[model samples]
Target: EAGVVQSPRYKIIEKKQPVAFWCNPISGHNTLYWYLQNLGQGPELLIRYENEEAVDDSQLPKDRFSAERLKGVDSTLKIQPAELGDSAVYLCASSLGAGGETQYFGPGTRLLVL
Candidate 1:
């Protein structure tokens, strides 16, 4: 079985610019994910949804970053007026169900803000 798919595997932009990333999860997976991984640190959950409702988004910066899984299959994460501090790898993952299940991850969209 294939893992999740994320587009534009790399991105570069100036500070305060807007950027968006797209993800397509594996077939039959009900949960999709978005996470942030800074240099030398483990990935941190940003937003997670099962079917179309976000179940965990406590770490997501609502002021600048947002995500949605409108159809429960594909998802998008957007950052408006992105900050230089936001330069990191945005990872996409999926699992059959929520909570403690093994997730399949994509290569991720690495962002570099100048």
Candidate 2:
């Protein structure tokens, strides 16, 4: 089976500029998530989607960040007016989210905000 896909494995941008990343989750999976992981820390979930519903998004920085999982398949995360501290790896994961299973993570998109 195919795995999750992400783009711009690496990125460098000036602070206060806008940036965006994309993700494609695995087939047959009903749950998708977007997470931000610092250089030396574990992933912190930004959003969780079950199909087209955003079941959780409490950790997202709404002031300058936004995300969406459309059609319950693909997802996109955007940062407006990025800041130096926004530099981190954006990880995407998917799972059945029903019977308790491990989440499969993608390679991730690393952002370097200047």
Query: What TM-score does candidate 2 get on C-alpha atoms?
Result: 0.95
State the C-alpha lDDT per candidate.
0.93, 0.91
Model 2 segments beyond 4 Å from truth? Answer: none
For each candidate, what TM-score against the reference? 0.96, 0.95
Instruction: Tell me how many residue pairs clash in candidate 1.
Output: 0
| Tens digit per residue, CA lDDT, model 1, 1-114 | 777899889999999999999999999999888999999999999998988999999999999999988888899999998999999999999999976889999999999999
lDDT by residue for model 2 over 2-43, one digit each (tens)?
898998799999999999999898998899999999988999
In candidate 1, where is summed lDDT lowest over 10 consecutive residues? 95-104
Scored by lDDT, model 2 comes in at: 0.91
Candidate 2, poorest ten consecutive residues by summed lDDT: 95-104
Error of 2 at 96 (Å): 1.7
Q: Which candidate leads the pack in lDDT?
A: 1
